[model samples]
Target: MTTASEPRTSTGVPLPPAATDQPPAPPGPAAPPQGPPAGTAAGTAPGTAPLRALLGYARPHRAVLLGTLLVVLVASASGLVQPLVAQHVLATLGSGGSVVGPIVLLGVLVVLGAGLTGLQSWWQQRTSERVVRQVRRDLVFRLIRLRVPELDSRPPGDLIARVTSDSTLLQSAATEGLVLVANGALSVVGAVVLMGVVNLELLAVTLGVMVVVGVVIMLVLPRIREAVARGQQSVGAVGAALDRTLGAARTVKANGAELRETGTAGDAIESSYQAGLLAARYVAMVKILSGVSIQAAFLSVLGVGGALVASGHLTAPALIAFLLYVFYLASPIGSLIAGAGMLQQGLGAVGRIEQVKQMAVEEDVDDASPVAVRTHSTAPAVEFDDVQFSYAGRAQALRGVTYTVGGGTQTALVGLSGAGKTTMFALLQRFYEPTAGQIRIGGVDIATLPRSEVRRRIAYVEQESPVMAGTIEDNLRYSSIGATDEDIAEALRVTRLDALIERLPDGLRTQVGTRGVQLSGGERQRLAIARALLRKPEVLLLDEATAQLDARNEQALRDAVDQAGRRCTVILIAHRLSTVTAADQIVVLEHGRVRALGTHQELVDNDELYRELAASQMLVGEDGDPVEDLAPVS
Candidate 1:
């Protein structure tokens, strides 16, 4: 193994000193702060900003929302008529008149109220679903378009939570919260007015009690919003933890670390449970407070109204009607408080969702029109001029390095593992931009072009030969959707994968399983090569493409490389020197700079580092073992 102190490649290039003191940063996006922002703190109410933003999401469905509001009003009116009908019945009985007509009217009002309530509920639910669906769709679109750096910082599970759970909160808040709050406020106002007409003293007493209770609820409301926000964050943490474990399920199982993984996931799950408990505690407090306020108001009304009735200041029927209105106040008051709570929860979710929306997103590209490859080119196809790059929390990976690879020629890049070989490939594909300097493709500065256009002309096959979970044919056609069956067959034949297909029971339809576990390493590598070939790109990048192949498969890969070189510029990185001996040119890199550039024969004769590599393998002894060391070059 290469150690930090004495980093050396097979080609004898020395690596930079390692900063082993600091642990390397994990790959992917930078992680955000552990907690929500200060604006989402526990003391803060679900403010106008969140509510206003939420309304923006609901704007598209405003027409439906308006209709639902009308339905709610009709329902509220039906509910109000029942109490008056009861009052009429009580008055008729007191006057010694027939009560049958008033009693029948009361029953009819009850039926009408029930029917209207159900219809209102149906419309409200439908509107909520539509709003949620649209919110989720918009979130998804923004998530996918986020810039690479932003994406790297966020966990996949947390993002999924935003799309699923966070959006669900908006559903309840948009329809139920808005509609209930509206109808409840209207009913409360109506009740207050009717109660005043019956008895002003009783109405004043009830309002006084409600005012005190409302103040208490307002104090507790902000706390509920805070707890709910934390709960949702905890839920996101659970999702992120599960995603981490499942994505590497095989590795955990193989290492017998299942218990450890489960423990880690359990911690996240426990956290979510605790947060939920906190939110529930606050919600319960709100419910108890609302109930107590209503009970207190009822007792006060009954005591005061009874004295007035006995004193003959109020009639028995008016007292009864006033008591009914006092009871009516309970429904709307409870509903209003509940709706407020739901709105607070949704506002918390909105904060999280809005954070994602505010992140930087990549510019849209016109994939319909790609940069056309030059049919006739005498100039170099790829060039790097004084390029430099540094990844986060690390020393520079590439120094001021410059080189040119001619069109339709095979150039092999040989370097130490940390000598920026992979970094070079990344720059070529514009997966990252150089911190300094320029890169040109086909005599055009790639910086001036869209990422999509730059990538359109090049085909890159990574060293790992990653395969998606799909059938053989699906993986093959991934890069080239328009590729014909004959085109696929030709690529398979060139990469010598035709025989594997013939032997499989399902031929091209054979499933590769997850990450192509069903295929051997060599087969996966060749499959990647075949996929790239089908693109017919102007430039082909093979990063240790034949690393897993045996001697026979390696030879077949060499043939494929030669054939590919005839039509496109081929640049490959390889550790095995023998495989690249026939390359048109070899560029050796050391410490992120070009150490030597020449053909196999020329480098072996003159370059000491090249000679050492050749002696390690090709320059064998008479006993068929490699020589220990060759004489130093003069």
Candidate 2:
């Protein structure tokens, strides 16, 4: 919603980072072990219910995840079988029985468990890739569909970060975290149960040690979740910084601000580094707790089991089996801790991703009937009926502006900067909604029509003449996908781009580098005009279309436009009095209001502002001499 009168930065600031070095954004609430869908559980966006958001992603891939979980369970069961087989081998040897059968069974179980572990690895990795892909796709769709106002509200860099870095965090969380929590819990239960059957005295001592560590772990987990959330926020900040700096690269270099700009990005990068350290610190704490719990329990069980064996309370094979179960118990506990950490990290990303999803997108009706094309005729082809409008949180850009242009005629808007001329074009294009009043095309209210339907009948060339990254032909057919080669040549010939196209080695296929930097300003302007003309729209809106052209090219384009004006309604905003002097009608805008409505000759005679602008452009003076013959005015 930035107007020509205001610098774009004046209208809106870039989105701020949620966390900084000094004060971090607090982590969201702890996630449920079995989270629900992101939007359903909280009836809100993803970040607030991050666990649910994660589950929502996994939900779509539930069959794959369940498959992965099953493999993990089978692998854990294979592992659990090893300790029992080893105990049998010991018992057989002690009984002086044939030990070969037990020994061979133990070796076979070891190989099967290894093979399942490898299979589980493949499943987890594959499932993680799929989850990340879906997350990125969802983010990309939301980003592209975001309304202009939403785009204006945030930096493009931070939005991109959601697709890149943030989505990556969700990959493992959806798959690995699921396997760890589910299989680990089951494995831990199975190991504890088997250990209890072998010796209750050893099991009791081990459980007591684990309870102390578990309580301590619960107390510290919330901090890890908070740290991870802040870390991801800082990474987003880094992206925002780079985007801002790189977008204005020329300006930064022109101002000799390379160091300063780099420092700005560096500051964000440093913040991310600090956050990374904080997250790692919390993760290390969890690992230490998990590792310490195992060691403590092992030592306590070993000492107690040894004493029991001495007292004949526990047999040798039973103590050996109980101890083996204690060591096996460590693997699942570590998995649970790792899974919890990954879930915390994924939850951190949910808030930023959800923030983007919450923004409103432009509504387009897919089933609405296409608007009928209007042919040449004398009627009010376009009308602004007491139209009132304003930018978000800004003063009115248009104030009860009322006017009408006849079909098959050209109407020019002549105004000083900030007089609402461009804003009129924006309103016509449905980029913004009017606060009050109606704008009609061919006597039909545009508001009642779908935005896409309305745009299909009108062609607009903006003042900036933006060119996207692509080949020349690619940009030409962008608006009208069905435009033929003959239509392209005709449009180019009209805008005087045909000669340039012919001179190029690649002709129409020439590459226009990023933002069309490979082309001159006038060439880009002509290219924009040609693209619009190719649409052959019912109504054409041009904003300073000839601003960059030399007199000869401008005159050629003017004649071309004049010829086309015979078959369609054309509304153009121009600061150059010469561009609109011969128009069928001219609307004078001043301070968001229509100050005058007349032909250029009529205005020069009747309105002082019109006369001044005409004189400034050397189109007219009091004596009305040709521009070159005119004497200098004080």
- For candidate 2, write residues 19-65 as lDDT tens digits: 11011121111111111232122236444476777788899778877
Model 1: lDDT equals: 0.77
What stretches of model 1 exceed 4 Å from their correct place? 1-48, 98-101, 366-380, 601-634
At residue 421, candidate 2 shows an lDDT of: 83
RMSD of each: 6.9, 6.8
Task: Give the TM-score comparing model 2 with the true structure, all chains together.
Answer: 0.89
User: What value does the lDDT take at residue 474 in candidate 2?
Assistant: 92
Model 2 residue 126 CA deviation in Å: 2.2
Best by TM-score: 2
In order, the Cα lDDT scores of the candidates are 0.77, 0.77
Candidate 2 at 44: error in angstroms? 3.8
Q: How many residue pairs clash per model?
A: 4, 0
